[model samples]
Target: MEFEVVVEGAAGALVAERAGAARVELVAALVDGGLTPSLGTVAAVLGALSATRVFPIVRPRGGDFVYDRYEAAAMEHDVRAFAAAGVHGVVVGALTPEGAVDRPLVRRLVAAAGGLPVTFHRAFDVAADPRAALEDLAGLGVARVLTSGQEAAAIDGAPLIADLVRRSAGRVAVMAGGGVRAEDAADLVAATGVEELHFSGMAAVPGPAVHRNPRVRMGGTAVPPEDERRVNDPVRIAAIMAAGRAGAARRARP
Candidate 1:
């Protein structure tokens, strides 16, 4: 089984790699559902890990997955930039006004990728029809899809995840993500039969104790407490991987 962690910086990437992650999806402002990280951050993460694959999610802004033409162009440019900086792959997604896969834009992004594998992001969960959306992505030659089966958590959506895996038939990889946890790893994997699992092993710890100004907030109403920061914990990550591997072993039993 392969484990992929969503990380915000080089530190988190190192922690994930040390805890046996096969890949890391680099991003920023995870509070905003992950935004395109700066190129410098991308370079730092790539330089920090020797073997762990890095797939940066290219989302210019959050709120909605529907992107305008300029945002589409920005996404394409970001993919090109990340590719140039030596990322293993890039994660991206877009949807039409009618809640379908934006095929033309994705096709252009894939072409811009120039050969690196493209993993469609969680926007597939929002598409009106998941089965047809999977086919559309496969037709576009996307290498993978990150989804929670349209549920808030992968374990809760195992049935759909399993269906996608069966439907894919190895043509596209279906990675179970979205609000995944260490405790549910074994059951999720055993039920879904997914070889790849994506999650963020976030545990809140005290941030800088010194609060310069408690009244001032960087993110306005959406700001998390400045006293603590959520990060991928190594111990939790290792445990999750072990649990997942156990599930995989059970799955392989004749």
Candidate 2:
């Protein structure tokens, strides 16, 4: 019955708050599947969105969920950093070489998080089996699990997500995320019977690079190339918020 918007920056957090989101998942390098944000970025987002809780992501690197000892150490450091900085929660997950949830590692990180909750990130999607992974995460006492239901997108995996919700049965919270758009969020919620939804309310922002660079001309060959970057846009955030609210409303209706 609630939506949590993932904010790539302070701007996105501000928009999420204005649009009445329950919480903000803060991260930097959104292009890299959301690595931990800088201290300044975290502080700015926390300060800016005083009302909305900020859950700083603790992903040390993008790409695969399997992390080496160094990366594991780095993720732990990030977890400690976020806890010290007073984040409401930390979003993180790690897998073993065999693609099973690293229970011991996750337990240590969850303890390092202090009193803040630990949300097992979408790395759960890549697990060998989502149902088994959910049981493992539940046993580890993870507060929540963010997943795409083992499908490419939440909508595609709604049936599985619904099953996950039913299987979890309050032992742990099941949050459906990944490729969740405004229009389809309600359907996802209804199909999956999940109470929490997550999405990056982003839009393409104008590039800072100029169309042409005279200093870089080579052999009288100058060709302009198009570039685009997706960043948090307040307008898009509002729209996503509207969609989530509409979904909640529909679900509440008799």
Best by lDDT: 1
Candidate 1 C-alpha lDDT tens digits along 49-157 = 9999999999999878899989999999999998999999999999998999999999999998889999999999899999999999999999999999999998998
- Model 1 residue 254 CA deviation (Å) reads 2.0
- For model 2, the run of ten residues with the poorest summed lDDT: 217-226
Off by over 4 Å in 1: 209-211
TM-score for predicted model 1 compared with the true structure: 0.97
Number of the top-ranking candidate, with TM-score as the measure: 1
Candidate 2 lDDT, 1-254, residue by residue in tens: 66788887887888888877888888876766788888788888888877889999888877898888898898888889878987899999998877899988898899899868899999998898788899999998899999888888889988888899999999999998999887788778777778888888787766677775546643233222234456666666677667666776777788
Count of clashing residue pairs in every prediction = 0, 0
lDDT of 2 at 106: 95
